[model samples]
Target: MKLQLETIIIFVQNINRLKSFYVDLLKLNILEEIPSEWLLLQAGGCNIGLHKMGEHYPNKSEGDFKFDNNTKIVFETDQDIRSIRASLMNEKVPMKEVKTFDNYPYWLCDGEDPEGNVFQIKQRKV
Candidate 1:
């Protein structure tokens, strides 16, 4: 048969920060939010859910902490890559240089959210 993916839940230490990044920054629509507990955002056909990390998850001191995860979230845009990248940079979002391989049809840039979750912004090169 066929399996469908509904939501992707990421355990985070701070829900508001994630909400700010995914909703405020990336412009994803929020489906639900429970303060300091959970946040659900709509990203195209799928939903991204942020669940507050419990006490079992170790947190470093309040300064610099980056979550090391094997997965990366990718966002596709119809807008110009350079323009979008500039906008995010102006908002103080940490982003890498936009690049594309010789034969690649898409231009891509990588960046991290407030809590250090890796994400990519992509657009087709015209």
Candidate 2:
């Protein structure tokens, strides 16, 4: 038996801001969007879905859904790590300093979306 992952839904406080980061900054193509409600983006083999928090979820009050600090979404890239880091910095995206793991042969840095959803950008060092 095989299981397939279809979409990853992230509840965010601001839909437009998160969409802009994925579309404008990361350059992920938009598959579909519903203003202030939902957005689907094409990211390689998977689709990333962003839904406005506390709006569409049933039985949820305003400010009920919050970004989880323990959740980290990672995107792997084949591009130059330094170049990607520079681009993110230029966009004023708050990011950690790019670093190499002592146990792994890759360069990685973390950044956040508008509402503080954390994500990591990583590139394997050649």
Candidate 3:
């Protein structure tokens, strides 16, 4: 028997805004959009789903929502760190200075979506 993770759901107040941030800004491919409710995005081999939350939801607020900066979605790759950093910089993506720890390179960036999720970009030595 084999089991694999298929998706990770991130809750949001607005689907359009989330879509724009994930699909347009981050350049993630959209797998499906379910009207005003949800959107499924392609993140490598796995999927990320954004669910729209109602005002009654416990976490919903009148203004913009804030996410825990400590929570990060890491995208791991063997791609060149310098090249990736250059490309992201050219696109004006807000990223932290690259740092090395335990012989690995990593950079952090805010996803800039409506929900304010953090993304950790990691480049493993090849």
Candidate 4:
């Protein structure tokens, strides 16, 4: 048996804000867009689905919806961590202070998506 992650969905108040942050600022490609309701973004090998809460599901109460910060999307690769960090900095992306653990390096950045989701970009030590 094999298990894999196909997509990460985030519910946001404003779809355009999230789209600009993810697609324009971060340079993520847009795979698909379902009008003003949902958008599918390409992130590495996985897909990120952003759904507009109030616009898509009007029947549901907006008060019932909440943003969850307990989970995070980690971008892992063999690319040089320092170089990647530098590029993001140059682009003026707001990132948390870089930290190292057991010689493994990682950095946390404020994704600035409409839902305020946190995105972590890291490189494991070889």
**Which numbered prediction scores highest in lDDT against the true structure?**
1
lDDT of 2 by residue, 27-110 (tens): 999887789987889988877878676534454232423345334566777777678778887898777788985666668776
TM-score of each: 0.49, 0.46, 0.43, 0.43
Evaluated at residue 41, the lDDT of candidate 4 is 90
Which lDDT value does model 4 have at 81?
A: 61
Better of 2 and 3 by lDDT: 2
lDDT of 2 at 32: 76
Tell me the whole-model lDDT of each prediction, alpha carbons only: 0.74, 0.71, 0.62, 0.62
Tens-digit per-residue lDDT, 47-110, candidate 4: 8878777533444323433234334465655676667667766776545555674533444333
Which ten-residue region of model 2 has the weakest summed lDDT? Answer: 58-67
Off by over 4 Å in 4: 54-126
Q: Write down the RMSD of all candidates, one decimal each.
A: 13.0, 13.6, 13.1, 13.7
Higher-scoring candidate on TM-score, 1 or 3:
1
Q: What lDDT is obtained when candidate 2 is compared to the true structure?
A: 0.71
Off by over 4 Å in 3: 59-126
